[model samples]
Target: MAGANYTLEFGLEAATDDATIIARTVQEVDAALERVIAAASTFNHNPTAFVVERPRFGPLQFPDHGLKIDVDPRLGVAALAWVGPDFDCPWVTKSDRPVPGASLHKDIDSATPFPDDAAITLDQLRAAVHEFRESGGHRPKCVEWQEADGW
Candidate 1:
């Protein structure tokens, strides 16, 4: 079977409404990510993060499969949430000790606090997103993941 088709969901300060971009190819996903990074880097920080998820098939779906990427361009780091079968696991770049006062996706009113040890650098985010696109929406193994408590 082919991998699940995916979509990118995000918001932009320049736009009155949120944006959703369907991605059927790796290039498309990359382009979307680049667009996201650009938007995130804007002085206003319109969208600090975005989500990549598998679209629901007519009658089949895997709500557990997807990733939430929180980007801090100024810091050159990003946090990844593997919202898959194992639940909202945060990628860990170091020990389990959470980053002090870590909060993600600030543009959204209900941004969730993440227990991420340390957000990966922009370069790593690129690799992880690439792996995710290639894997057809499966959890990317490009980095280490530590399960969050109560997740």
Candidate 2:
């Protein structure tokens, strides 16, 4: 939301409605759902009971916001939903394996405040993911680095 140059890119294969997707990406936000989805396994529910295919979103970038991020929140919701009970999609977070496990561990380490380490809240994770997504649009972090101020 910094500038008009905040370019949002979206990829839709089975999705024919790109406008709706874009709209949701920019305007709509649900704090309840957002807070509840604190991990990476909540998106794989097969309400159809036919087994849901794992979602694979590419590296998303927000150039103006300096936030490039991924979207996977199935695990946290599952935990919140069942606690000690068995979840329907045990293999949901298997989708997050490639970049989430080790990659996330390191990235979260770099982003968080320590001492209170190892305990990352939902908002923190959301912010980290948002930062990762919005860092690739067009605006580099230091726009004034090469400016001329008679220096």
Candidate 3:
């Protein structure tokens, strides 16, 4: 079956811990998935027929499979992406809310290919989040591809 890419972005305060951040991120994802199911219901599609891969916290695992969720607490940003079966649903799109202190890189382009080895460890993720926040959410100037390419 053909697959489609999806991403969900949200903001969180820097003072939040890893557990809280991950919990909140998962909750947002769950709500979005529910919306997708609801929307699909109107079209006679069985939303449950599509297998869902949930996100895991603490460390990145099985980088080659399922749904992946990443967060940058410093930027108060969280992102969720799916790499499996296409949902063929219209509700899966960019977030409508304006995330405060979020860089344009917050969302992953659905067309861009994600590498298998790109997984970052929990420590690395936390460090990057800390660094990004410490830097005041300033994104480096991109001289090559467009700004969205950096995300």
lDDT of each: 0.54, 0.23, 0.28
Two-way TM-score contest, 1 vs 2, winner: 1
TM-score winner: 1
Tell me the TM-score of model 1: 0.62
In candidate 1, what are the lDDT values of residues 1-151, reduced to their tens digit? 1355544443344332346665556677677677766666442333422235444534555344556656666655666666554444544333344445444452234544445575666777777776666665566677766664322
- Measured over all alpha carbons after superposition, the RMSD of each candidate to the real structure, in angstroms, is 5.3, 16.9, 17.5
lDDT of 3: 0.28
- Local error of candidate 1 at 77, Å? 0.7
What TM-score would every model get versus the actual structure? 0.62, 0.25, 0.25
Candidate 2's C-alpha runs over 4 A off are 1-20, 23-42, 45-119, 137-151
Candidate 2 minimal-lDDT segment of 10 residues = 77-86
Q: For residues 1-151, could you state the per-residue lDDT of candidate 2 as single tens digits?
A: 3323222332211121212122123232233223224322332221111001212234762111122222334323111100001222211111222232221221232432111122233444444323222432322232111111110
Deviation in angstroms for 135 in model 3? Answer: 0.6
- Going through the candidates in the order shown, the clash numbers are 0, 23, 0
